[model samples]
Target: MIAVVQRVYEASVKVDGEIIGSIGNGLLVFLCVENRDTDDKVTYMSEKILNLRIFEDNNGKMSKSLQDINGDMLIISQFTLAGDCSKGRRPDFTEAAKPDAAKETYNKFIEDVSSKINGNTAIGIFGADMKVSLINDGPVTMIIKR
Candidate 1:
């Protein structure tokens, strides 16, 4: 599993000109599931993104977690995150899980995060051609993998 997490002041996802998911003042998560990914990886990534201390506190230090700030989260399925470019100019996606399997893992991750955060978690549709927009807070982004 791999996740590109960005702290954002606001974020939204659109599919075919219709807004599917959006969030305010939280994290935007672009996730990918590799062939080897399991439910455990989903759980770990969800927890890590939620608990990361990347939000600013009263002292202007990045000391607050999503729970601490009562922030929101937008999760998007991004199979391209598994693109392999080591060999040539054209990226390869053989490492990425098949759509059927990847959607299952993506749904599991959304379920896990929703169970933890309740109403604050939003998600993009799996396998959709999604257009995502965000204002990255502090441009604070992290690439997490397992």
Candidate 2:
């Protein structure tokens, strides 16, 4: 599993001009599932992100975790994160998990996050064409894999 987490003031996902998921003052998680991933990877990725210290603390330091700040999360599925560009002008999706398997992996990851964050996690449709928008806070972004 792989995640591209961004600290955001707000974020939302739209499908067919209808808002499906949204979050505020939290992290926007762009996730990808690879052919080699398992539930263990989901567990590790979930824990790592929830405890990641990207937000600022009262002391003006980047020391607050999502759980510490009671923040929300917006998750989006993006298999393209696993794209391979080493040999061609067009990126290859060979490393990405097959859709059905990837969707299940994505669901499991979301479930893990939901349990820890008290169901404050919002998610885009697994295989839908989504339009994502966000106001990136500090422009802070991280790519994590397990």
Candidate 3:
């Protein structure tokens, strides 16, 4: 599993012109599930994201974790993150997990993180066309893979 996590002032997801999920003062996570990912990987990734100290502390240092700040999370399914672009012009998605398995992993990750966090956990539809909007706080982003 891979996650592109961004600290955001606010974020939202829209499907077919309807807002399905949204959040404020949180992390916007773009997640991808790989073929080899296991439940252990899901738990590891969730813990890593929740404890990442990207948010600022009272000293204005980047020392606060999302859990420390009680921030929200917007998780989106993004299999494209697994695309292998080292070959030809067209990227290869062979590393991405198959749809059925990927969705199950995605949901489990969401549920695990949701159960551990204090704030909201918003999600995008597993296979739908989604539009995500956000005001990136500090434009801070990190990629975690497990």
Candidate 4:
């Protein structure tokens, strides 16, 4: 599993002109499941994301976790994270999980994340054309893989 985490002042996902999920003062997570990903992978990733100390502290140092700040979370499924572009002009997604497996893993990941946070979890449709908008806070972004 891989995730691109971005701190955002606000974020939203729209499908067919209808807003499906949105959040404020939180993290926007673009998650991808690989062919070998399992519940254990999701568990590890969720724990890391929830406890990651990317937020700022009193002295303006990045020392606070999302839980510390009571922030929100917006998760979106992005199979392209597994794209391999090493040798060819076109990227290959052979490492990405198949649709069925991806959907199941995606749903489980969301459930795991939601269980950690209070009540601020929002998610995009697993296989939908989504338009995501966000005002990135501090321009803080990090990528994690496991």
Clashes per candidate, residues 3 or more apart or on different chains: 0, 0, 0, 0
lDDT for each residue of candidate 3 in 1-146, tens digit (9 for 90 to 100)? 88999999999999999999999999999999999999999999999999999999889999989999999999999999999999999999999999999999999999999999988899999999999999999889898988
| TM-score against truth, every candidate | 0.97, 0.97, 0.99, 0.98
TM-score of 1: 0.97
Worst 10 residues of 2 by lDDT: 112-121
Q: Which stretches of candidate 4 lie over 4 Å from their true place?
A: none
Alpha carbon lDDT of residue 46, candidate 1? Answer: 87
After superposition of all CA atoms, the RMSD between model 2 and the true structure is 0.9
Best by lDDT: 3
> Can you write out model 4's per-residue Cα lDDT over 37-98, one digit (the tens) per residue?
98999999999999999999999999988999999999999999999999779999999999
lDDT of 1: 0.92
Better of 1 and 3 by TM-score: 3
Residue clash pairs of candidate 1? none
Better of 2 and 4 by lDDT: 4
Name the runs in model 1 displaced over 4 angstroms: none
lDDT ranking, high to low: 3, 4, 2, 1
lDDT on C-alpha atoms for all candidate structures: 0.92, 0.93, 0.95, 0.94
Q: List the residue pairs that clash in candidate 2.
A: none
